[model samples]
Structures are given as C-alpha cells and as structure tokens.
Target: MNIFKRTGKMALGSRLRMLTAKFTDDASSIYNLYNIDMQPKWFPVFYVLSERDDVTITEIAVEIGHSQPSVSKIVREMAAKGLVIEKKDAADGRRNVVQLSAAGKAIIVKIQDQYQDVNDAVEELSAEANHDLWKAIEEWEFLLEQKSLFQRVRERRKQRESGFVEIVPYEAKYQSAFRELNVEWISTYFKMEEADYKSLDHADSYILDRGGHILVALYRGEPVGVCALIKMDDPDCDFELAKMAVSPKAQGQNIGWLLGNAAIEKARSLGAKSLYLESNTILKPAISLYHKLGFKKVTGRPTPYERANFQMELKLG
Candidate 1:
C-alpha cells in the first residue's frame, strides 16, 4: 500500500515527504499526550522569536529557513493562539515585528523539559536507521547551499556536452589576468597582505623569473582561472600551490580543477618531490577539492599570512 516505499530510490522526494509526514504526525501525537498545545510546524519560528525579541517577519523567515509569507502565516496562527504579539515597526510602519507573548513565554517554561525529551527521542530514532542520519542531513544541507539541486543537475548536463575549458602555461600577455584572478579571491576571503601584493604586482619577477610556475585557465578565449606553484627556499624539492582563483562567472565549470592539475603537473616537471598549500577552513568547497586531489592535512606551521589555519600537503608520486 506504500507506493513510495515500493518505488525505492526512484521516489526519493515522495519518500522523504512521507517520512517527514510520519515524524510530524508522531510529534503531534506526542504533544497531545503531553497536553502541549503547539503545532510541530510552528516550533522553528517560535523558537527563533523566543530567543530574538521584536524581530521583523523577514528576520524570522531568514532564521527559520522559510519564506516571509510562510513565517507570517505561522505568526498569525501563534497570535491566534495568544502565543505571539505583532507590532508595527516604529521606523517602518509597513514592517511587522514579532515577539513571544506572555502566554508563549509561560508555555516555553512548561514545555522546556519536553523539548529535550523529544530531541533525545529523535536521536534514538536516528540511531536505529543504521546510518548517521543527522550527519547525512547536515552534509546534504551543506551541498544544497553550495549549489542548488537544479543548478547542479544543469552543470552535469553541460559537462556531458562538448565544451572548451583550456589550461595553458603562463604567458606574459596574461599578467593582468593572473593578478586580477588571485586578487579577486584573496580580497573576498581575506585581506590583501604584503606578500599577496608582492606576488600580484610583480608576478614576472617574483614567480616566473624565480623558477616558479603559474598556470592559467581560459574559457571561450577569456582568462577565467589561475594557479601558482611557488618555489620554496627549503633544500628539498618542494613547491607551494598558492594564489589559485577562478572567476565567479566561470565557477562550477571545472576550471579550478584544470588549473590545479596543470599547476601540479608543472611542479612535477620542475622536479618537485612534495606539494603543499596553506588555506583556511572557511573555504570548505576548495578544501574538499584539494582532498579529492590526494592532499592530506598536516601539522600547522608558522606562516606569514594570518588567515591561514590549515596546511595540507600532497606527496608527489
């Protein structure tokens, strides 16, 4: 009788909806058994308003990951139940600010212990699934934030079709492209340090002339990506993969991969025995890509850049 369960993976969305409905129904039953007079769907918005008083509907929507209209509807329901109060913003009368009413505050005190019990029950249920459902859900949400489902599907479709994303060795003509690419990423994530300015302003003398290598990626004849292999002062044949950047418009097109591989190949050609890089943990997508390319985390070392929190190395094979 459960059509979605019969369809298996083919009905992922339907199955997920069914699972959510089951959980919601069970939550409703639990509330009724405990004499709690709140709906499961209103919990997110209610919790947010409880913590942040007198916030606008837009703020509640952002905190709860719902649309403003959806949050407004929840607020209306809570207001009808005498659980929330809405007031017109003094500065902007058009905006409606929401806060928990005295009844809602009292109810929170009444249901605080039950909330913890419900969370514990959720953990127990998740544990019975034979996999880390909470972790899986977290990863899924992270991936969705990195790229929407529709965008990822479209990218895969484009990858199947013929396209031109070319990685070329550094040329004198691409001097500005190299600087612009690196500066764009560096400035966005971290501030421009003295070393960054040195490399960006004098790529030829600081990098190319000093036996370092730079690779540039071109898409449709426009320079869209670049990565550098900076020769170190150490005695060993090691290179630092640094200053990698891809244009926002050309991202998700494998341009970073092209430039990264090209940089590694160039490093190897120049007798590099080990490749290392300094990056921040905030760059999750970039760090994931580096891991896929066989880079592993190593102990932290003193670095000139204050933003560097992670130092990873890839042993050249």
Candidate 2:
C-alpha cells in the first residue's frame, strides 16, 4: 500500500504525516546504503548546544521543541556516546548545562556537509515544482493557523486596517505618471543614467508589443507605482520583470513589494516558470528586496538593454 493510503483517513494530517514518514524512510535508506547510523534528530540538539555551549538542558529542550524528559534521555544517550558533556549550571545549581563534546562538534560539521547532498538532490528538482511545493506548504500553514480563534481574529483585524489595491493592466493615461514616478524614485534612488531615464518609453513599448503586460498601482484614482512582465521569446528563458518602480512618496508603504509581487503573479499567469530582472548594485535596497523575494545571482552580463545594468532571477511556479 502507498504510505499516503495508510494515513488517508486523516486527510490533511495524514498527508503531513506521510510526508514525514517518507522523509524518514528516505533518510534511513540513505544511511543504510552508506552503512551509517547518523541519527538525524540528534543533529539539531547538537547544533544548538554547540552554538551556545553554556546553554542549560532546558534551553536546549526549548530550542529544539522537545520536552525536558525527552531531551534528557537524548542528552544522556549522547553523553554515554561521548558526543556531549553536561555540567552543573553555575548560576542555577539545580540546572544542567549542555555543551557539545569535540566529537559532537566535528560530527555537526560532517552532518552539514552530508546535508549539502540532500540540498543538491532538492535543487535538481524543477524550479517550478519546488516553488509550487513551497507555496502549497505556506498555504497549508496559513490555513491551519486561520483555524485558530486568535489567528482568525488577528487576520480579520489586519484585513480591516490594511487597504488592499487590486492590480490592473497599465493604460496609456498612466504611462506619464509611471515615468514620473520612475524618474523621481528610481533615478534618485539608484543614481541612474540620464540616458536610461530617457529610454524607458521605447523599452516599455517593446515589452508591451511582445505579449507583455504592465500593472500600475492606483490609489485614489492616481497611479502610485508600476510593474510589468515581458514575455520571453525563448522557451528556455524566463519572463523578464520590467518597469518596476514606486513613487518616492510611497517608499515606506511597501508599494515596491506590491508592484514586484504583482509582476511575479502576472508572470505566472502567463505560464512563465521563472522571472528575471536587470538591476544595478547602486540600487542596494532594490537588490536587497529582490534577494528577500528569492532572487538569486547569476554569472553573466546583463541583457543588451539600457536599463539592464545588472541582472537577477527568481524561480516561479
């Protein structure tokens, strides 16, 4: 029987349980194949104690989300293995302080290196699949949290206080406003070239003609920011993120994030598996924002566009 089928009665809980089971099974299989008994659970406890050598056993338990008795049992086992050392807490004589032994510290480093193999296997999966998996996991977590009474009330209050604006296709009427916002915000923010500022209209036109769409952030009937997705002709290439700019007046209001997220959503809607953008190092905040949004650096020169002074890409599913 499929492992999932064994847990089918519980539906959502079953799926989660099955996932954990699969992970454990896979890990055990790998360990057996390598003729090793590297108990994965102990690694986290070792890691935490290694970082804070003087931490109390209770602190280790709390950090690793284990009960005191469970942690104590593991600690005693590890101590017997000479992987950890415990001492009476100096300030609180009743408490036992936990620290990694030399063996434990060395094993943690080895565990990290072996874990890189797991990371490599994960990275081999298609970017779209990884993105979808993470997105589904996040949605599940959010839905689970929403089931809590306190979370439901908190979400409702947040929605009531924070006004949300829908993303709409950019129109010609908003083009000038977008341009003004770009020049006012981006140029000043990044110290962009004057020629770069002058070339946006033509570049934007080129993108729009190529099955691309721009969304302007509107508040009170005024365009506050702009973001766009330009379709890539190359099937192997991702859609390009273009014309992302927020009004200077709206800098701290997360307008840039809204615009960037809208561009990502639009790119996904267009059947794009990834999104790429051109940016400069001078735009540190923008670069930081892109990194925060999961963009990674690529080893190549920017595309032959005036605004593509630098480049970054984010996988989308």
- Taking all chains together, each candidate's TM-score versus the true structure is 0.53, 0.46
In the range 1-317, model 2's lDDT, one tens digit per residue, is 47656666546555767688988888887756654445656666876876777787778888877898988888888888888898888888988788888877776656665578777876676464736676777797678775964565666654542365445787778778767776776556555565455446654556677677878887555677787677777665668776688766656556676678878877777778888888877788889989987889875743654555678888886
- Candidate 1 per-residue C-alpha lDDT over 10-98 given as tens digits, one digit per residue, 9 for 90 to 100: 57777789789998999899888778789999999878877888899889888778998998899999999999999988888888789
- Candidate 1, TM-score vs. the true structure? 0.53
Cα RMSD for candidates in order: 11.4, 17.0
After TM-score superposition, what is the CA distance of residue 223 in candidate 2 from its true location, in Å?
0.9
What local lDDT does model 1 show for residue 288?
89
Off by over 4 Å in 1: 1-155, 158-162
* Residue 130 accuracy (lDDT) in model 2: 33
